[model samples]
Target: MLGVEAQKSPKGKWTMPPFDPRFPNQNQIHNCYQNFLDYHRCVKAMSRCGQSSQLCEYYFRVYRLLCPLSWVQRWNQQIQDGPFAGKI
Candidate 1:
């Protein structure tokens, strides 16, 4: 499950993480969140285009609306700090 730090405060808590240079520089984390967001957005767009709602509801209803979105959000955070720093 996603730890408290990766959560988006859907329940009114503060959503941002305290900055730490040792790890993610925001883009990585933001990209991950956006990836999930994109999937759901496509689902909606598809629905508007006459696709059945049941076709892609899995990502939004079963995943995002549930607790797994936050957990899937931590995919890149499991790496050690600075692993990608100053690479070619």
Candidate 2:
């Protein structure tokens, strides 16, 4: 009953996956922040060894959906200046 029930795919079709209710009690803002952290961590680990970051794209997409533009802009700046710069 929680989470997004329908998301528009690249081809513009609505697909339903198995219902897996994660973060049942957490709000969307918290979820977005957590997702951002996870994504950047994944990117850092993957790129540190010269690995392709194609697998980390999922977290970026989810974060984009749940976070606001202001939050993204601030985080982008942090990522650019912080230790994770150029990795994500």
Best by TM-score: 2
Clashes counted in candidate 2 amount to 0
- Model 2, 1-88: lDDT tens digits are 0123222222322233222267565466667877778777887788898998667767766776777868777777676667544334
RMSD for each of the candidates:
14.8, 8.5
User: What stretches of model 1 exceed 4 Å from their correct place?
Assistant: 1-27, 52-70, 73-88
Against the reference, the lDDT scores of all candidates come to 0.43, 0.62
lDDT of 1 by residue, 1-88 (tens): 2346433333333334334353355344444344445455665577679885445433333234333454554433432243422221
TM-scores for all predictions: 0.31, 0.65
Determine the C-alpha RMSD for candidate 2 after optimal superposition of all C-alphas.
8.5
